[model samples]
Target: QVKYLNNIVEQDHRRVRQRTRSMLGFKTFMSAAKTIAGIEMMAMIKKGQLNIPGSTPFEQFYALAG
Candidate 1:
């Protein structure tokens, strides 16, 4: 049962692996971390996972921004 769980994590890591491969290298780990964070955040937003209760993600973002 636990053996199958790693596949889920590996699948998630595939996106980051592909991106890093395409970019070759970053100047610093911070830059790479920020890029990965942004990519994951965008994925979550696109999947409607980042939206606030009773609000769209864009609306939640705007509310937090102001």
Candidate 2:
């Protein structure tokens, strides 16, 4: 279990570095970190067809789907 955990961390570290490597180093590290966090989040969201919350106006959505 410890070895498996290390592997997960290793992969995540490589991916995060790769992502930030393309970005311009910001004036402040905290600013850069927040921007990277937001970009990563948005990238995850863009990866697939996201399910919108079911709380939408269902009649309109149903009509649109039809």
Alpha-carbon RMSD of each model: 3.2, 8.9
Predicted model with the maximum TM-score = 1
Q: Per-residue lDDT tens digits of candidate 1, residues 1-66?
A: 696998998887777787778786899989888888767765677677787788876776557544
lDDT of 2 by residue, 1-66 (tens): 485898876664565678779877789988887766655544434443333555344443344345
Global lDDT for candidate 1? 0.75
| Candidate 2 lDDT trough over 10 residues, lowest sum | 42-51
Which regions in candidate 1 have their CA more than 4 angstroms from the true location? 53-66
lDDT of each: 0.75, 0.58
Q: Which stretches of candidate 2 lie over 4 Å from their true place?
A: 43-66
Error of 1 at 49 (Å): 1.4
| Worst window of 10 by summed lDDT in candidate 1 | 57-66
